[model samples]
Target chain A: MIEVINLRKSFNGQEILHGVNLKVNDGQSLALIGGSGRGKSVLLKHIIGLLKPDSGKILIDNEDISKLRGRKLKRLKERFGMVFQGGALFDSLTVFENIAFPLREKTRMRASQIRKTVSEELAEVGLSGAENKYPAEISGGMKKRVALARCLVMSPEIILFDEPTTGLDPLIGKAIHTMIRSCQKSYKFTSIMVTHEIPDIFSMVDRVAMLYNGVIHAEGTPEEIQTSKDPVIHQFIHGELEGPISIN
Target chain B: MIQILTLLRIIGAFVIFVIRETGRMGIFLAEAIFWIPFPPYLFGRVVRQINFIGVKTTLVILLTGTFTGMVLALQIYFTLSKFGAESRLGPIVALSLIKELGPVICALMVTGRAGSALAAEIGIMRITEQIDALDTMALNPYKYLIIPNLIAGVISLPLLNFIFVFVGVWGGYSVGVGIMGLSSGTYFGNIRDFVTGADILEGLYKSLSFGMLITWISCYKGYFTGYGAEGVSKSTTQAVVLSSVTILIWNYFLTSILVA
Candidate 1:
């Protein structure tokens, strides 16, 4: 389980997150939705200890993440896998090596075992036989698949996805969503995804939280969020220009 | 009075910026040094970087060393002959190459070739979030990305400096003995008499320190790169300029201390 209490973050004297509170129970998938530049990624980074909040307590499995230091923080991080917006695949390594990277660096597995494990992961992501190709040689969608495969290879207890489908085509985006959903079922890890996929994302996630003006504007099941009458939620979900939520 | 106040403010801000950046660099150096002894030692990566920083840089070092030596011999012979001190030409050329020119010139060249590339490569990784990804994966970015380069820099520079000096001495011999009509025996004899072990050691020390400075500045710039393609390019430029300038400035101090 993860809990964020009264979280706040500011950059260059401008506050982006203000006393925001959120929680995700173990084995649940939560989709964080917000307008552009609403600090969705910032919040995700804070939760994963990538960015420290100006004031807040982030509890992961009941331990305060912000208070953890050095080896402890590293140990905490080992339980996490984050899929970045750009896949963040190591450009120098081939697809196989990228997926096998964590295993090679952190584990004592033999070469044959690593190869077997990587092949299985590639097969899971439907990236079979694409092992030798570099990140540049592959399509954006393929890169995301490789990123997901790499993340899953660790079997982390918690998974964070930062705008995973942002730049892909609709079909590819949907395929990625499906893959995440299937992987979540298989891995049973706590999941938080920052995305803008709207109603389509509703089908995959158990809960939806809308962030507005540096706060959680609303939080509920996907169905409740979809049918919400809150003007901010409605305006955001309907993609309206004029509403309680002002556009800059 | 207001104009003076404004000027003071500008100077104060610049001073603070310099102090802050120096402190940051100091902290960066400390952290890099701290991780040096920790294991999961990546020997293969170190070897690869040495190949890039040292072996591949050999030809440029050789070419520059040769020309520099020839130029020095020609100029020194002309000046020395006017004073009837032409016998000193060989020792002067050997001393200059071994004590100063070899380390400084070789370092500047490596800064251009390998140091800039290291900055740019790591800058791209920073902008693209590969470093962050490594952190999330429970891997230390310094261990994987930095320490190897640091080790390579320390290991490669001294060897390359030796090559530069050796090639440069022969280059001076070719000019002094073959072209200037000085006795080969006199040229060789002068170098043997005047060049001490301490001079060679001083050169070694300069190269080793230069290696550390170049990689340290380059890695620091890249590790803290701002945001995009523009950020990467800016970091790369700063890395090269800063490393080269620092090498020259640091060489003066090192030479002063070593000579004393």
Candidate 2:
């Protein structure tokens, strides 16, 4: 379980997050939907302890991750997995090496064992054969899958996805959605995914949270958000210009 | 006056931040170095970095070091000969090359070749959130990225300086003997006479110190990059400028304190 309470963050004096509050139960997927520059990424960073909150606590598994530091902080950080939006694979390492990275760095597993584990994870992602190739040689969707494999290598309890399907075509997007659903079903890990695509929310998500006006404007089941009578949620879900929210 | 004081304070803050961060890096480096004696080591990455950083720059360091050594020897020889103290040229050439010129030149060459590129690459990784991704996955980026880079730099710079001094003094001896018609034996004997245990240690010290400074500055810039591409360019530029300036400053200080 993870809880965010009155989280506020600012960059260069311009307040980005204004007292946001959220929570995710165990083995659940909560997609935070908002427009670009809506502090979705900021909130995600704070939860991962990437961006420090100005005030408030981000509690992961009953521990306040915000106050942790050094090796202790790093240990807490190890419990979470983050897939950067652009499929941030290390270009220098091959796909096999990339997925094997966390296991080698963090655990005491032998080389042969590591090799077996990496192959298994790659197969799980449906990317078994491309292990020898560099990130640049692969497709964008494949890179995301590799990132996903790397994320799972550590067996994290809570996974954070930052715009996973942003650049891929719709066909690949559904495939990615399926992959997400399948992984969640198997692992039963809590997940917080930041995304803009409505279809993704409709097809796969169990619950949705709408972030607007620097706070969670609405939160309910996917069905509830889609059928929301509130002007802000309705306007946002329909991608309309004129509503209770301004263009800015 | 108030504005100046505020400006000075900002600069002081930045310096303090650099000092603290570098100290943290040094502590991490010490722990990692301690692990070097343990078994199951991988020298593949280290060897690759050495080849890329040291072996690749062999010709450039040689050319620059040779010219510098030759010029220093000739100028000192001419001036000392006019004073009927020509034999002092041997010690002067050896002292200057070992204590000052070799390390400075080698560091500058690397700052130009590898340091700038390192900063840029790191900056890109930081901005693109790759490093952060690594961190979230329970990986010690210090182990994977910092240790290899720091070790490669520290080992390579001194070896590079050794090459520089050898090539440089040889160039000087050849110029004094072949081109300027001085006796070859006399030129060789002078460098040999002047090179002491202290001089060799001083050069090695300078080489290692400058290597640490150059690599750390570049790494730090890249590690904390902001503002995307523009930020990356800024960090690379800052890494080169600061490392180059610090090298010259440290060379002067080390020479004054150690050699004097």
Candidate 3:
């Protein structure tokens, strides 16, 4: 479970998020659909404790994580697996070490155990034989899967995917969506995915929140999001330029 | 009063930044040092850096060492010759090569080669988001990136200093005795008389501190580098500049403190 209250953020004097509040119950899948530079990634980073909001409280499992610092913050961070916008795999490390990273860091599992767990997770992601390859050696879709495998390796209770399908082809993106739905069901994880792929996310999400003008203008189920009377949300969902959203 | 307050505030912020960054580096250093206590050592990465990042730059070190020794010999000879003690060239060159020239030259050379490369590599890693990946897995990027380089730089500089002194003294010897037709007896005797245990200790001490300085600055700049590709290149250049300046500045102060 994750909860954020009145989250306000600014970068260098420009406000990005203005009093945004949201929450997800245990075992819920929520999708945040927004245009670029709309604070989705920033908000996700705050939840991950990678960045702190100017004012707001982010609670994970009822613990305040927004202001956590030092080693304490790092330990809190290890609890959740995150698939970044890019795969973000270490260039120098093999896929085995990449996925095994969390297990090795957070647990006393030996190398043999780590190898076994990493392979299992890789297999779960359909990347079993690709373990020895580096990120550069893999396809974009495979890299994302490796990232997801790493995220799920700790058996983390929650997973955050930032634009999981941003750079993938349409077919690959659909495969990723299948993986998301199936994995979330199998793992029973509380998932918050920040994405711009409205249709793919709408098809997979239980609920949706549309961020606009530094606030969540609408929150609803998939049908409510598509048919809502809210100009910003409707225009974004419909990909229409005739509404309040500027063409630029 | 406002000027003084502003100055104090700037200093406060700088101090805080250093403290915060230092703490980041320290936590990482602790984790890295802890892993050293266990089996399946990750020194493979460290050894790669030492071999590629440190050893591959030997030619540059040799070039800088030889020229530096030659310059020191010329300067000391000119200054001491005026006092009709031109024979002091051997002693002056020996002392300079052993104490100051050796470590400082080696540090600068390594900074140009290893320090810049280390900074750029980490800076690229930072810009490319690879380090952020480590964070997601609960693996500390600072530990994985900074500590190994810090230890490598710390451990490598002294070894490099030893090489620099040996080659630099040989270069100085070549110029003073071989090229200048000075007798080997006078040169070797002067060196034997002039070099002391304290002097050698002083140079090693300066080298250790210089190692720490170059490694810290380069690693910090690279670790926190903000921009993208442009930022990586900028940090690389900045690392060299900062490391070199820090070395020169610290060399003087450290020599004065530890040597005098």
Top candidate (lDDT): 1
Candidate 2 error regions (>4 Å): B1-48, B84-86
TM-score of every model?
A: 0.99, 0.90, 0.88
Give the alpha carbon lDDT tens digit for every residue of B11-67 in model 1. 999999999999999999899899888887999999999998899999999899999
lDDT of 1: 0.94
Clashing pairs in 1: none
Tens-digit lDDT string for candidate 2 (B1-260): 99999999999999998899779656655765665564335577678778867888888998998899889878987887789876666567777888888999899999988889888987888877788886676555555555566778899999999999988888777667767777777777877777889889999999998988888777777776667789999999988998899899988898788867
* Model 1, runs deviating above 4 Å: none
lDDT of 3 by residue, A1-248 (tens): 78999999999899999988898888999999888888999888888887888898998878889777767776777678889888888788899988887776678999998888888998898987897898889999999999898888888788999989888999999888899899999999889999888677888989998888888888888888888888888788888879898766
- Interface DockQ of candidate 2: 0.67
Alpha carbon lDDT at B15, candidate 1: 100
- Chain A TM-score per model, please list them: 0.99, 0.97, 0.95
lDDT tens readout by residue for model 3, B27-111:
6446555655444345766787678556887777778777777777777777776898878788888787778888888888888
